[model samples]
Target chain A: MKPQSMGQAVLIGLALIYLASLYFMSSPVWMGFTINALIVAVVALAWNITGGFGGMASFGHAAMYGTGAYASAILQVQYGINPWIAFGAGIVAGAAMGAFIGALAFRYGLKGSYFALVTLAFAEVLRICASSFAITGGGSGLQLRLEPGLSTLQFNDRSVVYTILLVIVALVMALTAWLKYSRFGAYLIAVRENEDAARALGIDTYRIKVKAMAISGAFAGLAGVLYLQVWLFIDSAVVYGSAISIEALIGPIIGGAGTVWGPLIGTLGLHLLGEGAKHLLHNAPGLNFVLYAVVLICALRFLPQGLMGLAARIGTFRKKEDDNA
Target chain B: MLEVRNLSKSFGGLKAVSDASLDVPEGGIVGLLGPNGAGKTTCFTMIAGFTRPNEGTVRFMGQDVTGLPPHRICALGMIRTFQIVQPFAGLTVQENIAVGAYLHHHDRTEAMAVARQVGKRLGMGAMLDRPASSLTIAGRKRLELARALATGAKLLLLDEVMAGLIPSEVSEIVGIIRQIRDEGHTFLMIEHVMQAVMSLAETAYVLNHGKMIAHGTPKELVQDPAVVEAYLGHGAAARLQEGHHA
Candidate 1:
């Protein structure tokens, strides 16, 4: 695939530099907020793998996120496994869940809005089951022990955890960058454009989509694990709710889905917008959502292809002008 | 290189195709001619493994490949281009061809090189960087052929590759097809353009009412009475024969 190119190197370097800069922020509170946004950003990146690249817009990404969170939490609190090991296991469990759901959905040839609805149902079913199960601590959920250390994956210094999270997100961004020009990436895009055409071109589109969903699940699961390590607790409503799923897709949609940098950029941009709304309308908390709706409407209206598309349009414009000159 | 035997397909008892058969010898250009709704595309779908036949077998390169999926059939060196010209609209012309090239060349660079070579061979050198969506109908048709060719498949089943084109464009495609045939690829094409078929096809099969009505040289099929009645109507074949006599 020629993945480890200068572009990927530059991307990872930029990510590390951005994380180093974030460490210098004066307020710890803002750092925590940034960490939360980073976790959501990870989920958005996960969404980009399938939703953007593969054109499988999942409305139930929370199924993977919540599955990861609950799996790790259950392993630590119940089985008494090492938190770090449980974190790895949680990511695997989430990926397996993603693969399982993807196989079933794609097997039945569910696509478009039908595929989205099927995934939504899977997440809803998982939420109900997680709430009912005793191992998950029912509606109250599970909490890890108060022990805080690198071994436990919990950090006394928020910066340590933030750096780790950013590093993981950066690795995923690198992988996404690889997907930009790789053969698999081409297959994914071909499947997205037209599955029949892709098949005729000798691409196993069903397999590619399942793999994309699994990769997306791994990252979404990692995002969940990050949340658990930060909070030391997880509940069905908090983790498996529609809110996380909605948050996961919103970033990619705004920043540009199916691009190397769109998901992360979109997530960060949304959080900044949310913070601005909070400051501007301090008295009315919910009014910010109304403003978000307005911005989202405008974004959809003007930039239908998202931020990366805007960049691409400008790039082609310049290339054309150069040709003219 | 390609053979179909008694292929039958019924879309809920409508009998889209029944007992239709044709064969293309190695390195030959064969045409499948039928009017609209004559089940020509259905026959292509059956051979390309997009649809299974009710009763029949498809032998490509002397191997039975019936009921297989399209991708597997493509990997076996047989690929079909859609009649509607299915291009990955968001991708550039080169990228679109590269998607097919990936079948033979796994490396992106290697595939892109093959895509460029095949695209330019089909006279699409200047359009390589252009987006597939921007191409006109003729460009898209050439793109369709280029993509199938890019797969490095030995046999191509083209469904209406020149359905909508100016006379000059049609002639250009006919020349391209003839050149490709001489380069050792076999072809089974469904074409409504009579001039291109007569000029390019060594043998042509006629389908009417989901049945094979005739199989002969394009000139011979043009004179057959049943084929004339089912396809070209009464006066058209007489006019063609008089032109031949003259």
Candidate 2:
């Protein structure tokens, strides 16, 4: 493999190894937190498709996540659908929602901050609708039965859920790697770099971005369904809240916006920092968030390219040292 | 082959281009010579699908492609380069050209091969791995040409690719363009540098104040009074008749 592929393989291998080790940990609460962090990582990876690679940063990604959650929840609670079928349906719903919002925004030429704001509005609108609509259980949320079996995709042991998310993160990571070498990824990045140049080169940037959004939405939606299954409950705020949107964007930004392993690594680091803060502060109410904000500000200010950029810089430095030797 | 008929564009109260027409035959070098605001770039934009002309038609290879988007025009075997080169800052020079090469060759490896070949042909072979943002102005100009050629477009509307280059660098580009022209690609170049355009273009059209004032060979345009007046002051055409050079 080329050095580029070598870097990607090493990064992905390390991420997979860390994720697999989570299954062996016996602590229930730690396992729960790990699973939640990994789940958020998936959505962050999804966000990276358009927000990172395509440079169409979204601030309301919870639209697709909430859409998937509500779709699956409504199916099981109201229509007597199987959990597995609802899972498939929910991902499709998320992709559809992605396409809907992407088409609406791109067709109107909304880009940069405008695109971000539109997506946020879409999520907020979905949250309001999910809360007010009767089909979505209105103010009350839907809950899955406490069945501990593979059939329902829920388990008494948290390890099963952790393993499932591992496969998902691994697959998405591989997909991100594929994009690193794919023609579509080149055009998408070109669009991100210079839309006019991309268009002049015969790239239909509109189609590429919409497809990226659909793919992104599918994973984010998958994360939402996964969240619903593990907790056995999902309400408007739990699924469609702006907090999820913020989380989806934050992990990728902190890790490395456009790299394959940036989202996972960033999410893990942030999760640990957050948990460590909670422990040191005696689980204080909002103090952890205060520290989180400070760290985020610092990350943005000093490490604009995030942790992956630092790693790349160090890698080059070591290579230079070796060349000297 | 590209032809523009009575093309005009106005930005609210300002007439950027008015009733301007140009024709480029196959495998020929055509020049659009004008002053700073002669609407040369505007005409290029309208022909290449970046802007819609308020009046007139653009026919490419016998098809009416007046208001088609740039990508569509590109697929129909025509491309344009900007006056200000916009390379993908995050990508390497190879990857930057590969974006254009991917138009015909869908396979990534195949596209990369085409990009490499085009880079080699354009004399930027050694810098393919370098990030596009690292290029000098002349390098960027070559990159713009390399990318446009990599797309396999038969006709190129270059909007001043040699705008910001040194004389030696401009000569290098003029040689590359001549080589490409020999390879059977049509060129409609908007050039402010008369020396390069005079040596390169067989046919020339001069636009003054958004209107075509003269159409002839480079030799004929140098002597045309209207064209001379467009460049120099008014009576300079009469002075040129008496063998007085500026």
Name the top DockQ candidate: 2
Tell me model 1's lDDT, rounded to 2 decimals.
Answer: 0.87
Q: Which residue pairs show collisions in model 2?
A: none
- Give candidate 2 misplaced runs (Cα > 4 Å): A1-20, A317-325, B239-246
Best of the candidates, TM-score: 2
lDDT per residue (tens digit) for residues B83-160 in model 2: 999999998899999999999999999999999999999989988988888888999999999999999999998998
C-alpha displacement of A101 in model 2, angstroms? 1.0
**Model 1 CA RMSD to the hidden true structure, in angstroms:** 3.5
lDDT of 2 at B127: 87
Pairs that collide, model 1: none
